[model samples]
Target: MIYDVYTALPTTSVKEVLGTFEKNKIGGVPVVDGKGILVGMVTDGDIVRFLSLQEKVYFTFSMAYVGETEPIEKVLKQRMNTPISEIMVKKNLKTLSTDDTMESALSLLSKHHFKKLPVVNGVGRVVGIISRGDVINRLAKMTSDSLTIS
Candidate 1:
């Protein structure tokens, strides 16, 4: 588990979330409230899905015209100000506790196809984050150590 977890707030802007992801080289973050309670989650996939463009068309008896669409850059710029809460996954969040074992973490990650899971405390405060890579690395290290001659 990564103790130094990066997180976002519900009110955080989409632009800020993108910046966090870029700076930290992460694909997703758990959204927390003011008191650091896990509320939702946001990911690159969510942003991509939310920003998918739908082309509109207008037709008349004598002519057909495609509705004008803004460039992606412009569209992104316009959407940057939107709050992450608008796109965050608010329901059905799966989380882990500090006492959860590595096996449990791996099971949840694989079962739900989650890249990461937030570790929360008794009161629902985020304590850390566990990722698939973290678990795999730990397992590899353990296996190697067990195989090595003392």
Candidate 2:
């Protein structure tokens, strides 16, 4: 029942989200609305995919440089300033409820292969995140505490 969590807002820019990710060293964040309702989810992989799939729409700086290859780094940087709402996964989000059993969470984790599951309230407001690391640590601690080393 870890309660402390981090989240992002829909209007958050890709640059700001990247800074959050970099500072926290996290892989993903739940995107919320002004009222803390889950609107979408974003991840490092999402950013990478967005950058990679962008068509090289090079508006020429000059006639001489028309169609000339722009540096990939520059292209990536330019796109990083856009709002995350455009790129976040907003449909069919899977989530856990506050009262859901741990087995249910584990089942979803196993079936979907997600590293973490967002816990939400009845109204789809994010409460916390349950990660694979959290499950493992809790289970390991329980096991170790139950064992009798003679």
Which has the greatest lDDT? Answer: 1
lDDT of 2 by residue, 1-150 (tens): 557777999889998999999999888899999999999999898888877744445455664323445678987778988899999999988799999987888888889888888899999899999888887887899899999999
Candidate 1 lDDT over residue span 1-150, tens digit each: 899989999889999998999999999999999999999999999998877665668899999888866678877877889999999999999999999999999999999999999999999999999999999999999999889676
lDDT of 1 at 9: 94
User: Candidate 1 clashing pairs?
Assistant: none
Q: How does each model score on TM-score?
A: 0.87, 0.83
Candidate 1 residue spans exceeding 4 A from truth: 57-70, 148-150
| Model 1 poorest ten-residue lDDT run | 48-57
Model 2 clashing-pair count: 0
- Root-mean-square deviation of each candidate, in angstroms? 2.9, 5.0
